[model samples]
Target: MHIPDGFLDAKTWITTTAAGAGAVAYSLRQAKLALEPKRVPLIALVGAFVFAAQMINFPIAGATSGHFLGGTMVSILFGPWIGALVMTAVLLVQAVVYQDGGITALGANVLCTGFIGCFVGYGSYMLGMKLFRGKGRAIVAWMSAWLSIVAASAGVAVLLAASGTFNLATALTAMVGWHMLIGIGEGMITMLVTGYLMERNAVMTGGGFKNERLSRNRA
Candidate 1:
């Protein structure tokens, strides 16, 4: 969900701004430390896709909108730090160029949608994978994506309540309720895309090894 300007009050935005900045800074370091050279292109591609997917959002509340957030998919394919960075970049561009989200509320949006979504979704997916002993990958991805959106909405709801936009219950009911429905469709999309990519990668990897062995035998 993208929060427009004026959605958050001064104190709330300021606090979230500092927190978001810190999160982005930390993410930069982590991503750099764990960066894989080949995955850079994939990161850019996923970032572009996420940016495009988020453009088609529907207004949910007074100032916010609901859309497909690619946090879970990114984290699953790459890592949480890269996912956070990708989301932050997407939010920054949308705020600056498109004005889809507000500059004033950028920090809150980043905190809620960028950092919170990635970390929560990634953690949930990892936990599911562990519990299932790495079985049901598609199911785990779908569930994690669904949970990520809901959790991100809950973060937005809390901020809305803090900003006095609405009381806690009202904000939660409105934001989380709308997003819960949105999450279902978005989650399925995330699942399908992630599963296809994973399956394709596996095939390509296996085929490469097989070809390499054949070449060596021929040589």
Candidate 2:
């Protein structure tokens, strides 16, 4: 979800920029810890794939279009930190080279779609796995992805409301309403990609508590 320039007031943009900067910094450190040598090239490839996929926006209800967010897919394959990093790179490329998202609102976009999206999806997946004892991994992945998109849209709604662009109630209704529909597409793509990529053995191995290897294993 790209916030166009002028949608947010100066104060909102400044505050979000600071928050986004902090999130990016913390995520970078987490990425370093999560990184594996063999995964670097795959991470780059995922980044490229995300970048390409985002370009083809599918028509949604009304004239608006929605695209694959890719946060859950990346996080499932790598980790949340790497997913965030990859999303950041994708947003950067879209803003600078493709001019799809505005430059001034780049930080806000990253905050909503990159930071919040990645963490929410990945965190929910982990929590669901724990709660379900990893039995319905695919279902968990779908729900995680669906919820993440909705949450990210809520974040955007709050930010826009904070900017005084719209009342909180109205913004929440509009943003959440549209994104709920959009998130169906996100859930489908995330579930398919994650299911296709995850090893059958890895799915079974998730029951082992203290299995740090599962965390490190790339899909």
Candidate 3:
């Protein structure tokens, strides 16, 4: 959900810009502390993939288009901090090189799509795993991905309402309604990609192969 220029008022954009910058800075620090050397290249690759994935927007109902938001996939494969970083990178590139999103509105987009999407999706996945005792990771991933989009849309709706672009009730309903369909696509793609990339045996064992390898290396 890229918010174009002029969508947000000065007050909203400025506040969100500062908050987004702060969040990204904090996430970078956390990523640096927890990041593994091997995962660095992987993060870069996934960031590129996310950038590419977001380029193609499929037409949805009401003449609106929706694209894949790779936050959940990245968070699941890596961690929330790195996932947020990756999403920030994707947003930056899209804003700068592609001009897909507005520069002034960059902070808002980052806050909604990068920060909120990653954390909510990651948190939901974690909660789902805990509740299921890790028995339905794919399902959890799907649901998390879907919910992340919906949550981000809700955030955007709130911002739109705050900006006086639309009333809160109307904005929330319209944004969430369109995004629910978008979330289905998001969930399916996340589930398929995560399933293909993750090892079945490791999934069944409630650990990832990459994590197991990392643990063994540490030992």
Candidate 4:
């Protein structure tokens, strides 16, 4: 949900810009500490994938379209800090090169889709994993992906209301309504891709079922 220029008022954009800047800075620091050298390439690849995925918007109801938001997927593989950074990079490139999102509204877009999406998705995934004792990881991932989209849509609605573009209740209803459908696509894609990638990695890293059983027997 990229906010075009003139959608957000000056005050709203300014406030969001400052907040986004601070959040990005903090996330950078955290990423520096948490990021591994081997993960750099993975992060870059995921960021590029997210950027490309966002370019293809599927039509929803009411002439609006929705694209995949990859915050949840990245956060599940990496962490929230790196996830936010990757999202911010995607937003920056989209705004600068493609002009998909407005330059003036860049901060609002980052706050809503980058930070909010990553944190909400990651937190929900963590909570779901805990509640299910990690047995239903695919289900948890799907739920996280779906919830992230809804949460980001709600953030955008709030910003639109704050900018006086529309009433808060109406904005919420419309944005959330369309996004609920969009989130299904997001959930399915996240579940499939994450499961595949994670499983492949487990096999490559000798953490698959056979390896694990062998190791346990040796112990």
TM-score of each: 0.87, 0.92, 0.91, 0.89
Please list the C-alpha lDDT of all candidates, in the order they appear.
0.85, 0.86, 0.87, 0.87
The Cα RMSD of model 1 versus the native structure comes to: 6.7
State the lDDT of candidate 1 residue by residue for 87-148, as single tens digits: 99999998999887888899999988888899999999988976996689989999999999
Ranking of candidates on TM-score, top first? 2, 3, 4, 1
Candidate 1 ranges beyond 4 A from true positions: 58-65, 200-219
Better of 1 and 2 by lDDT: 2
- As a TM-score, model 1 comes out at 0.87
Query: Native-vs-model 2 lDDT?
Result: 0.86
**Candidate 3 segments exceeding 4 Å error:** 200-219
lDDT of 4 at 153: 96
Off by more than 4 A, model 2: 202-209, 213-219
How many pairs of residues collide in model 3? 0
Q: What does candidate 4's lDDT look like per residue over 19-136, in tens digits?
A: 9999999999988877778878888898888888887888877787778989999888888889999999999988998888899899999998999899999899978976996679
Question: Model 4, residue 69: displacement in angstroms?
Answer: 1.1
